[model samples]
Target: MMASAGDMDTGSVLLAEKVTALSDPAAYPEFTAAVTAVETHFSWVFLTDGFAYKLKKPLRTEDMDFTSLAGRTRNCEREVYLNRRLAPDVYLGVVDLMATEDGRLRLFGSGRVVDRLVRMRRLAEDDCLEIRLKRGLVASEDVARLARGLAGFLTSQPPLGPVSPVGLRHEINTSLLDLAVACDGCFEQAVRRVTARLLAFLEYRSDMPGRDRLVDGHGDLRPEHVFLGPPLRIIDCLEFSDALRRRDPVDELAALGMECERLGGAWIGPVLLEAYGKAAGVFPPAGLCAFYRGLRALVRARIAVRHLMEEPIRAPERWPRQAAEYLRLADRAAAELTVPSGRRPSSSAAL
Candidate 1:
């Protein structure tokens, strides 16, 4: 006989028990031996036969706090809502991890809610842009599809007003400071040069395209989050902060290009930008695009190095090497940030 919800324990079950239960194939309605668990910095993703369930770790960070059930639940709901903008069919809904009267855990069953999980349709690993790029399977048409899809999504969104260059500088400066400490000042000169160039661009480049055309965009638009399709689907947006999501679309695209280039697809960036320009009807100036790419690269470098600060770091040796690589890329992109001479302005108004 099965336990009833009315007979369940009032106290919330331990997180470990919930994790253990979900890790088992039997916990799901359709059990399979192919169930695999992946642990990210903030959540545990359990991939079953046909679905993926994400359980947020009850942790607090400087930027985000998932310490309370309400907080996690809200974040999960936000994620589903925001990601639907690009990957509508992928974000299914939020579900509960419940505890039954028989001292057993179940998903979506009648019992006391112990935890929340985001249920999503599992996508093919091979279809992800990062995997395809590594395997040399990405083509021009694929990137064009991504560009058009992304441009359509972005253009459909309402503008969230202009982003402040001062705020951006402060954010980048904080990250650079963290990177300097994390790398033992090894990249101090590079950081200084990058920071100076970025500051110069922000201060003097009022004529830069898209200064006033900010929109709520996919904040973390990396290759791993993109799935190549006849209709491309982008997932895992920065749902934690609406303020962060308010960005220039060109800035977001530049970040995507930077990540793609880092993954050995340098040609993808220009193609994406060109296609996006055609679709959006606003070609971002070369100087502005270079500035954005350099800015994103520096920030990415900081993110890569900051991984070393994690307790029991994942792949300790990989972070520094990757950080160095990002720094090199940042330097190369920053080198292209030459303030324009007296040149004729374009007919386009914004990016």
Candidate 2:
């Protein structure tokens, strides 16, 4: 996806608008109750006392646009719609951040709307799955329970028919290419290993042809996005792209497995895989699981190293190490891509 000069100019203009209009805390007086504001990839999140406000950044990518109000509004609506499938209680709705005549921004008020934001109920921060992973407190029961719950969640949505083989290949290759370009410093060798495995898997699609119908699911079903129960809530689906969000259940479960293995909970990964197999009555192909898990690891590794691109001179102290760790996970998972190189296994044994 090479960018044209016009595309570059358009992206720059949109980025400038976001930085100028949405970045200032002082601009949004209606958010006076906000405890803090956090920046995500393409949105700004304001954490109020009981609610969270996520404002789109009006940014542009080759495949996505958050620049126009109509575009943002539709995406905002889609965000609520898709996320409600998993966390109905959490994604409250969408609200307009209108610009008042007096030049101040008011949220959910009558005026000319400047930007659209997805409003959500804030989950318990301390109880996020990351904290549990960090403390080594995740019980086998918890993993099993999450697996069962996730299986139900994945199966709840009606299948959208088999995902296109070509589209699936594009999805994996695009991310892998970007990763190779983004984390070349510490990632070159390991990335080559993972890329080779993914390429091999891509070639042998008949063996792991993703037979399941795609679900509109949590595209980024990571530990950090999950909350441990009393009531389990997974917030922040990839609202920006439907192609990225649509996935087979096995692929989605494998993503969680990848993250678990990354964060020192290696035992938890196999438990999740086993749970999914038992609950869903689907023995996901070994190579398919390994490919999905490795691809996800490489994706996370790319994200971690993007800070170098953003602030090469003074990126965070921890990112290089984090990137290296992710790359190692990528290599390990890729190397574990079992079954013969070009042989096609029975695509579904448990189904």
lDDT values for all models: 0.80, 0.72
- Model 2 scores a C-alpha lDDT of 0.72
Candidate 2 matches the true fold with a TM-score of 0.81
* Clash pairs (backbone) in predicted model 1: none
Superposed Cα deviation of residue 162, candidate 1 (Å): 1.5
**Would you estimate the TM-scores of all the predictions?**
0.90, 0.81
lDDT of 1 by residue, 249-332 (tens): 888999899999999999999999999999989887877778888888888788788778666688999988988888888888
* Residue runs of model 2 more than 4 Å from their true location after superposition: 1-34, 163-165, 171-176, 179-186, 204-206, 303-320, 339-351
Query: Lowest summed lDDT over 10 consecutive residues: which window, candidate 2?
Result: 1-10
Whole-structure CA lDDT of model 1: 0.80
- What are the per-residue Cα lDDT tens digits for candidate 2 across 1-351? 211122132223343354455455555544444357677666778776677778776556765776566777888998899788778899988886665677656664466666668888889877687889988889988888888888889888878778665665555555566566663444555676676666666665566666566988888888998887767777778877877888877778888887887788888888988987899887787878887788777777766766555522344766678877877887888887754654642332100
Instruction: Report clash pairs, candidate 2.
Output: none
